[model samples]
Target: MLHLRVIAPAELRNPILNVLQREPGVTHIVLHPNAAVEPAGDEITADIAREAANDVVERLKSLDVQNLGAITLEVLDTVLSSAAYHAEDAADGDAADAVVWDELVARTRDESQLNVTFLLFLCIACLLAAVGVLTDSPVTVVGAMVVGPEFGPLAALAVALVRRRMSLARRASAALLIGFPVAMAVTAGATLGFEALGWVELTSTRELHGVDFIFQVGPFSFVVALLAGAAGMLSLVSAKSAALVGVFISVTTVPAAGFAVVAATMGDWDIAAQSVAQLAVNLVGITIAGVLVLAVYRRLQTAKESGGRRSAGV
Candidate 1:
C-alpha cells in the first residue's frame, strides 16, 4: 500500500482530492491547504491520510495536479508497515533523487578507484581460488566462487539493456572487461611467484588434471551460463537479495578465470586455452541470458500496466 501527502493551494485542493479519492488501493485522503512555510513557500507541512500510498502516487501523477506545492508518497508493506514508512521518510526523496543517478553511475563506473574493503575482498577471492587450485579443494573453490564480485556489473548491464540506457551498458561492460583481465593477470603473476618460492604446486592434483574440469566446453556450458544469468537477474529484481549470493556461488565465472590463471602459469597451453574458452562461454551466456530476462520482464510489466488502465477505463 501507499501513503501520499500533498501540499497544494487551497483552490486546487478539490481537484487533487477528487483524483486521490478515485485511486485504487487508497484507503484515506487528507488535504492540507496553504500550510505554513517560509517566505519562499518551499517548505510546507502536510499530514498523510492514506493507507496505501503507492497507489496515490500513481494517481496523482496521472492527474497532473496543478498548484501542487509539494508531493510526497510513501510505500507501506502490510507485514512491515511501520518499518517501510520509516524507511521512506528517512530517504526524504530529495536525497534519494539526488543520489540515485550518481549511485547508478558509481555502480557502473569503469576503472574507478575501488575502496580498500572492495579491493581486499577481490584479492581474497582470487587468493582463495589460487589456494583451492593448488590444494585441489572443491570446498575452497566454492568459497572463492561465493566471494567474486563479477555479478554486480552483470546485473547492472542487464538493467541498462532493459532500460535502453547505452551509457550504462557501456560503463558496465568496460568494468567487466577491465576488471576480469586485471584479476586474471594478477592471479597469474601471483601463481608464478608462488611457484618460484616453492610454496605452491601446480601438478599432482587430480582437480588440475586435463580431463577432470579443465575447460571441457560444450553446449551445456553455454546453457548453464544462460540459466545462471537469468537467475542472477531474477535475484536482483526480486526482494530476495540473499538469493543473489547463492547465484554468484552457482556460476563458474570466478572458478574458470582462476583455473585459466593457474593453467597459464603452469605453461599448459592446451589447458589454458580450454579454461579461457570456458570463461568466454560463461560470460557470453550470462550476458545473453540477462538481456533476455530483462526484456521479458519489462514486457510483462508493460502488459500488466496496460491491462490495469483498460480495466480502469482510463
Candidate 2:
C-alpha cells in the first residue's frame, strides 16, 4: 500500500476529494480544510492500494494538483486497518507487481545526476578494482563492484529510453559518458603512482588468473550482464535493496574499466583493448536488458488496466 498526502487548492479540493472517495482502492481519507499555509489550501491524506497508485496519481496529476499545490506518495510498511485490506483486495492486481512510474522517475532523476558524490564513488570503486586487478583478488574485485555507483546512471538511461524522458536520458548519458572516463583517468594515475612506489610492476607479463575474467570478453560475459541487468531492474521496481546488491556484484563493469585503465597506463595495448571490449559488452548488455524489462512492464501495466476497465464495463 501507499500513503498519499495532498495539498489541494480551494477550487480543486472538492474534485480531488470526490476522485479519492470514488476510488475503491482508497481508504483512511482525511481532509483538513485550510490546513495548507504556503499553498493556501486543504490538506488531504489517504491510504491507497499499490495496484491503484498509478491510476490515482495520474488522475490527481491531470487535475494539476502537483503544480497548484503538492502531492507526496510514500510506501506503507505496515497498514493494519481492515479497510486497508479491503482496499487492497479491491485492486486489480498484486501489490508487489505494481509499478509506480512517478516514483520511479523521481528516484532515477535523483540517482542519475552527475554530482560530486557519484563521481567520487565511481572513482573510488575503480581505484579499488585496480588494486584487485594488481593483486589478482576476486574478493577485492567483488568489493569494488559493490561500491560502484555506475548502475544508477545505466538504469536511469534505460528508464529514460522507456519513458521517452529526453532530459533524463541526457543526464544519465552525461553521467556514464563522463563518469567512466573520469574514473578511469583517476585510476590510471593511481596505477602509475603504484608503479613508481614499487607496489606492483605493471610492465611484467604477470598472468592474473583470478581477475583475468575482467578482460575476457565472451558470450558468457554478455549473458551474465543481461541477467544482472534484468535482476537489477527487477530489484529496483520491487524495492529490494538486497537483490540490488546481488545485481551489483554479478557484473564486471567496474572491474573492466579499472583493468582497462591500468593496462593502458602500463602500455599493454592488447590487454587494454580486450578490457575495453569487455566493458563495452557489459554496458551494452545491461542497457538492452533494462530497456526490454521496463518496456515489458509498461506494456503489462497498460494491458492490466485496460482489462480492468473492460471488466467493469467502463
Candidate 3:
C-alpha cells in the first residue's frame, strides 16, 4: 500500500476529491480545508493500493497538482486498518507485481547523477577489480562487482528509452559514456602509480588463473548479463533489494573494466582487448534485456488500463 498526500488550490480541490473518491483502491480519505499555509491550499490525504497508485497519480498530475500544489506518495510499511485491506483487495492487481513508474523514473534519475561520489565509487570499484585481477582473487573481483555503480545508469537508460524521455536518456547516456572511460583511465593511472612506488609488479607473461575468466568473452557471458539485467529491473520495480545483490554479482562489467586496465598496464594488449570485448558484451546484453523487459511491461500495463476503462465506460 501507499500513503498519498496532496495539496491543491481551492478551485481544483473538488476535482481532485472526485478523482480519489471514484477510485475503489483508495480509503481513509481525509480533507483538511485550507490546511497549507505556504501554498494556501487544502491538504488531502489517503491510503491507496499500490496496484492503483500509478493511475491515480497520473490523474492527479493531469489536474496540475504537482505544479500548483504537491503530490507525495510513500510506501506504507505497516497498515493495520480493515479499510486498507479492503482497498488492497479492491485493487486490480497484486502489490508485489505493481510497477509505480513515477517512483521508478525518479529513482533512476537520482541514481544516474554524475557527481563526485559517483566517480569515487566507480574508481574504487575498478581499483578493487584491478587488484583482484593482479592477485587472481575471485573474492575481490566479486566484491568489486558489488561496489560498481554502473547498473544505475544502465537501468536509467533502459527506462528512458521505454518512456521516450530524451532528456533522461541523454543524462543516463552521459553518465555511462563519461563514467566508464574516466574510471578506466583512473584505474590505469593508479596501477602505474603503484608500479612506480614499487608497491606491485605486473608482467606481460604473468600466469593469472583464478581471475582469467574476467577477460574471456563467450556466449554465456552475454546470457548471464541478460539474466542479470532482467533481474535487476524486476528487483527495482518489485522493491526486492535483496535480489539486486545477486544481479550485481552476476554481471562482469566492472570486473572486465578493471581487468582491461590492469592487463594494459602489464603490456598484455591481447588480454586487454579480450577484456574490452567482455565488457562490451555484458553492457550490450544488459541494456538490450532491460529495454525488452520494460517495453513488455509497459505494453501490458497499457492494455490492462484500456480494458479497465472500456469496462467502466470511461
Cα lDDT tens digits for candidate 1, 126-198: 7677777777777887898899877777767776776677877776676677777777777878888888899
Sliding window of 10 residues with minimal summed lDDT for model 2: 200-209
* lDDT, candidate 2, at 88: 95
**lDDT tens per residue, model 3, 1-314:** 99999998989988999999999999999999999987889999999999999999999999999999999999999999999999999999888888899989999999998888889999999999998887789999999999999989999999999989888889888888889899999999998998899988878525988988888898999999999999999989998999999999998999999999998888889988999999999888988888988988888888889999899999
After superposing candidate 2 on the true structure, give the runs of residues whose Cα lies further than 4 Å from its correct spot: none
Instruction: Order the candidate numbers by TM-score, best to worst.
Output: 2, 3, 1
Which has the better lDDT: candidate 1, or candidate 3? 3
State the RMSD for candidate 3.
1.2
Give a tens-digit lDDT track for model 2, residues 93-148.
Answer: 88888889989989988998999999999999999999998888999999999999
Model 2: lDDT of residue 4: 98
Give candidate 1 regions above 4 Å deviation: 1-22, 26-119, 203-211
Residue pairs in collision within model 1: 2-52, 2-53, 2-54, 3-53
Best by TM-score: 2
